[model samples]
Target: MSTLRTLFLSPRVTATGHALADAARRRGARVETLREWRVPEQQRRAEGSSLYAGPLFADAVARELGLGLLEAPQDWLARLPRELTLRDVEFGTIAEAWRLRRPAFVKPPNDKSFPARVYPDGSGLPGPDAVDGTEPVLVSDIVTFAVEFRLFLLNGEVRTASRYATRGALDVAPLERDPRRAEVLAFAERLAGTGLPSAVVVDVGLVDDAGWAVVEANAAWASGHYACDADAALDVVLHAARPEGEFGAADRRFLRPAPEVVRD
Candidate 1:
């Protein structure tokens, strides 16, 4: 294979892309730095398009250069190929806001963690939490972020997994495997051919009490790299960029022998 040329699509002083690029380069790959690329202001005005012009540019470049695309997590990532944002909430009058359920939240849909209090609690505290209650902000039902899982993807395939800690940092090994991790992996398998971008990290969170719900999917744009096996992730990158061979859609059978329950 020709020397793999990678162009890092991010701003300067970024630790995420820098680390990955360094790893890829030391492994005999030629990497490029494309810090100039970012989502333009005008592209936001496009009508009814799910694709963001900025990341889409990287997606194209990755295709051309045979490089992989990694991105940070964000609202847009949850709505891939649709340019849909998890923002844009249904705001209501003061009366309606008062009528919100006990655990229901009154936060800007744009905010990731809800409550915005000194902590996510009833005591709306010192800062942004006290913003105008009547402003056209977002409100949503609050779900407990019990332990979270971050499944790294190279191209569209999943690499090894880890947990997303409270400080937004990646955690290596934690006690007790996620109860619903098995189901989450199954969900990822369903998207095996959905044309998701290469070099991406998928964050699948569980809904409170719901079995293995997709909290949100993210592009690798602003994602963190913790315990991500560079070699394994890179392999996914190389495989996705190559010409796809003709394969049967239903060729692989899952039901041949599924996993059995662990009887204690």
Candidate 2:
């Protein structure tokens, strides 16, 4: 069997990134780093243990490296507690949402293809030429979150979590025993049973008016750890993203599962 090799394409790994790499190394995986977006043919042929890329180049790099980065399901938020309030605008039908006119929060369902924010209306968005009509976008009713947390999940479990923000400020406090923690864990449990991706980042928040609600689900490989336990987060990242696989369409209700293993 070939030894596992982890690759990262970042000029400088952040503290969290370094921690993850260190964790992988501790687990006996050889870690490699490249400053370029493109992986050489020889490097790509090695036994890949894991891969992480910068946000700006993540999607493109993943495609070139054939990494499997699981994304959030389109209708996942609707299946959670805040479904009644959150809305979805399909790629080709966003004009209808714009017709609604009422103020609402808008963002791409998976990728950061476009900015996620409150748009006054369809007119507020960039012209049609700038927005891809094939990518689905989420337009939700605006709500206030008193606290927000990011949970790294694998095999229907919360491996590690962190309180990244409180109220509106950018905070990085460690998670503690609180009602919010319990609430988000329960939410994750329910989401796991719903046939979500094998590994993922489930973001939950304490809404000032709506109690605990889901904020969004992001790909673990591309998400920031904030104050999360580096070792634990690394575990989730390992399974969540891979060097190559063909996704199964029926594994998750909406989200796809990674392909079968590819050994060197």
Q: Per-model C-alpha lDDT, please?
A: 0.42, 0.67
Task: Please give each candidate's TM-score.
Answer: 0.46, 0.81
Whole-model lDDT, model 1:
0.42
Compared with the true structure, what per-residue lDDT tens digits does model 2 show for residues 50-161? 6665455564455556566666676566555444223343333454555646777777666666678888776776556775444566777778888888998876688899
Please identify model 2 stretches exceeding 4 Å from their true place.
1-3, 54-56, 79-97, 177-179, 245-264
Which window of 10 residues has the lowest lDDT sum in candidate 1? Answer: 251-260
Residue-wise C-alpha lDDT for candidate 1, range 1-264, written one tens digit per residue: 234444244444555456666667787554545444433443322221111113434443333332323333222333343212222234443334544434444543222333432224333422344544443333444455444566667545567665665333444542125555576577667555544445455655544454443434454444554555555544543433332221123312200111222333
Clash count for each candidate, listed in order shown: 13, 1
| Stretches of candidate 1 exceeding 4 Å from the true structure | 1-3, 34-140, 154-156, 166-184, 190-199, 235-264
User: For candidate 2, what is the lDDT?
Assistant: 0.67
Top lDDT hit: 2
